[model samples]
Target: MRVTAVRTTRAPAWQWAGCAALVLLGAVIPVLRFLVFWPMDQWQVDVEVYRQAGVSILIGRPIYDAMTEAPQLLPFTYPPFAALLAIPLALLPFGLVGWLWTALQIAATTAIVWYAGYRLIHRGGSAQPLVLGLLAAPMFWLHPVGDGIRFGQVNAFIVLAALMDLRRPRPRVLSGVAPGVLVGLAMAIKLTPGVFVVHYVINRRWREAGTAIATAAIAWLAAFVAIPSASLAFWGGALQDPARLGPNMGTSNQSIRGVLMRVGPSGGAGVALWLVLIALVGWFGFRLARRAWLRGDTVTEVAAVGLLACLLSPVAWIHHFHWIVVAILAILGADPLRDRRRLVAALVITVWFVCRLPWWGISWIAHDWPPILVGRILQNADLAGALLALWLLAWASAREPRDAEADAVARAGERSAAPGKVERRAASEAG
Candidate 1:
């Protein structure tokens, strides 16, 4: 009777704490939106772009030609398939849509922590809700994540979808769609996620690669069927225009090419330099990603590939760095706090990203400060961190020997499943 009474007394206190945690997580974006959005970004401007694209679809305006009203005048730069998906946002008032979009971003962020941070959450025992809520709150404020909320960007969804495609690779969607479909849809929406398809290919996930290709084609084809002109405009030329994204040399453009544009040679020389560097980055990044894969660390594998996408893109805005959220989880690994070194590394990385290092770099350059070198380094902080992360992940993965038994089993499964209907199922689980 005494134990039961004590347990009952603590139940409400635990529930209250859990509820408080949930509220804190929910408030992160709202607080950031009002108190923390940077001067450069217009509030939810990308959402406005998406909403306007939907309006374009409903009103028969050319999506590419249509620009958001006022000074920003941002045009729709995403593929036609994304425009097709935005039709629903068009139906709602912008005010309502903004609120809903913010909520969705929160949900997506929570889902990401849930998926990638599951191992940590699992060890929390009866305190999973408290653990999840607390973990999610800080993640929501990660610069990229906050930027996603402020700009109403689609990046959180893409990260979540890609994570699910890799982490939980067996589930179906809407009762029919397969594991790779989410990644496919993501690629169709924005070509950035095409990196995931490359991951599948290099790893010889042929069926998944094929499924992703087919799914992306279907989406683009569907858009082509629905709005042939817009489809043609996107695939024909608009997709190639990096200019539409923004100033390449600006602080927000954190890709390697962006760094080169700011500091390296210009014209043909810059192009050649970027190409050489990109080729090297691709080879090295993929090698590390594959290393994480062989180590059976899905979080690191996904994180490595995601970092590659951000670093290699022609115009990766700050919001795209949200991939760092998972990378942080990967840094922590299964043991959240047992290893002092790991905990400190994760903390440093988290703090490094939360602060706007790149913008500080820009401030120094703008002010003509004496130590311009320090500023220059700070300006490309995200890119530098990404490269360093790849190296560290590769090094860490190298320390562990390969699982010969698992490799042997995968090979055997591959052999028997070849030319068979269950090949994809076998191959997917074998790894």
Candidate 2:
């Protein structure tokens, strides 16, 4: 008997060209910023807050000390470890730090796209265009990556973390650790990533989930120990903060709440509707994951699960949907354009950026319409856009299942349960 190892192959020159083109587009975005005539002050809002937080951390000021005199004006709501993550860059001057940080984020995005392409090719065992399509998926190109980099955000790190954990082998205690750290760090920076933890637990990834909880606990504990008073203040105000911040479902939030708020007032009724919607989305996502897992879907399906989670969240922002990059790549890994559903998914993803165009063109469109009406229309557009994104998520989740690895693990577990399987159990235990 002979044993053989299977290795995935590379695509042809045209496919290489396609990958190169996508890479080129990604690389050029940062450099092309000068051509856009948006309000420079608006751009400064998010960055300036982070820069101040970085500055405060460098000094002896508490991590949660008001960058603005107001307690709620911190540019974001994040845990303490978020400040710790920015400590290294805080050492640099602000201009240098922002540029360097943005560059690194762009690089991270490229790396994730490349890894996603690699994973899809490795698992799909198909032609180069398929690999190229996966690499250049519109969902990957537009939306989160575009807006994330344009805003100099760190969501790409979150994308990388989730992608790294997909279809990881069983007994992967250590394999789960890195993603756990990343998830914690992402949550530390922004609370939105905390939702991923819940998704992990729902999927029965107990080890990784435990590690995620532990990592976040340790990180926050360190921060609390360093700045007990600030931590106390945060918790003290935490209960009242959400109401003060307003429901995210409003158009202002670019979340589910934002959509409902656009429909009506963002009052108690709106909040109730948001909660019910969230429950429905979560139920469907869980069912989708179980079906895919039971049907023996590949690791890529985990990405689809992530996309569903994001859609179901009440507060997912445009930039927050960056996880779609991983989801599209996962689908590509399982099927090519020959798979019509996947092809349409790719097209829908490609066109998603169109929603942002209205906001971008609002300034340029000096129309005769009343200012209030224009604002209302833009808000309605955002609401529509959010729903479209959710629709795409539902479509992807319903596609063909690919849980080959999970099925194999289930079979292995069944074998272990059989009589006279003591030796196999012992070997597994030893490892």
Candidate 3:
């Protein structure tokens, strides 16, 4: 008996070649524009701060010492492990480091969009590339993303780390260990990501949560070994002094504390007000996460947790609002094509962020506008947008769906996981 040969189908040669070209252009264009054309004045002042911290470590100086030589006099505000991470950058020339850092940031931002689109929005087959391309280009222009790049801030990397922990595929052995370690490493670098430990707890991923805490502890110990004095300084004093970080009442500080400091009571009363707001937002946001988990929607859960972290942090600078990318993807994932209201709401939120309306509004308020209420609202646009996004997601998730609607979502998730019809069509065409 004769055996038949198997045939496999592939996209036409031109299609494959065109896709490769697009990917190359997409990566190269942004790096060239950001590194070469962007003014040197904007070449990541925060990165200089980090580099100096590394230099301090090497020279036996305290990492917390203010870099008085720098224009900003910015102190190294991150955890000691972060300073260790900066050592390589410290060894490089500033010019070379800036270019490399910008490129790394661009790659991180692209990864964030790709992960958000694929895992959150479930874009499969050829649609995945299109979705990634669409998100990647606009993502570079978003105020927070641009600001993060400009300052050489680590927010992009932090966001990427969080996504990695949250979206990593389950492995056979020690499945939870990888995610926990990633999150723990993130927290070791910057404290805000500790909020994810709460996420793991709420989800009842005990092993992952424990691993995260343990990993962080190990990192802290290692840093202590490496820089005993600096570690003590950071943990003993510098960490507590919010003033050392930056002006809490400034427009750049977009947390609830910032809002209260600007317009509400001062001193003890302001602190109390901020605590109350934090408790409320934290409760509501975590509740939404649990509800989203129950509904089998991890995207919403991630967005809610991220928003809570930014809103609750003492100093969530404009760059920290990179979490807005999560909110945008979650909105799109929540049946935007079928839900007109959600589609419109998502569009409005995207436009608000893309135009950097909040920062612009703060600038307007500085001109001594009379309508203080509107001015304050616009001035706190980042916080307001975060609240609105959280509310919309909570509301949408809370709505009891029709049986058919729930079934559709379930089916969509199933399809997202498996090969899509488009893939089949491509195969057939090739055959």
- Which candidate gets the maximum TM-score versus the true structure? 1
Those runs of model 1 whose alpha carbons end farther than 4 Å from true positions after fitting are 1-32, 35-41, 168-177, 396-430
lDDT of each residue in 1-431, candidate 1, tens digit only: 01110010122367547845684656565556643554444667899999999999999999998999776789999999999899999999887887788878878888788677765654554565676787777786567877788788899999998887876222223236665788898999989889989989999988878988899999999999999999999888888887888787888898989999888999999999999998899999888777677656677778889989998888888899878888887777655455556567777778877787888888888999988899899998988877776666665445444333322222222233232222122233424
Candidate 3 segments whose C-alpha is farther than 4 A from its true place:
1-42, 119-124, 168-177, 398-431
lDDT of 2 by residue, 35-84 (tens): 14434444424445666666676776765544533432643356666666
Clashing pairs in model 1, backbone N/Cα/C closer than 3 A: none
- Highest lDDT model number: 1
| Residue 325 Cα positional deviation in candidate 2, in Å, after optimal superposition | 1.8
Per-residue lDDT tens digits for candidate 3, residues 1-431, read 12222122223555445544554455564455556676666567888888998898888887897573534677888899899999988899988888788878877877777565554333233344444555566666667877787778899898877766774222123344565788899999999999989978977879879989999999999999989888999999999999887888898888998888888999898888889999999999998887775655655677888888899888888899888887777676634566667667767777777677666777778887777667778888888888998998786566543223322222343343333322211111110
- The whole-model lDDT of each prediction reads 0.76, 0.55, 0.72
The true-versus-predicted C-alpha distance at residue 60 of model 3, in Å, is: 1.9
All candidates: TM-score: 0.86, 0.74, 0.84
Candidate RMSDs in Å, in order, are: 7.8, 7.1, 7.0
- Model 3 C-alpha lDDT versus the unseen true structure: 0.72
lDDT of 3 at 367: 85
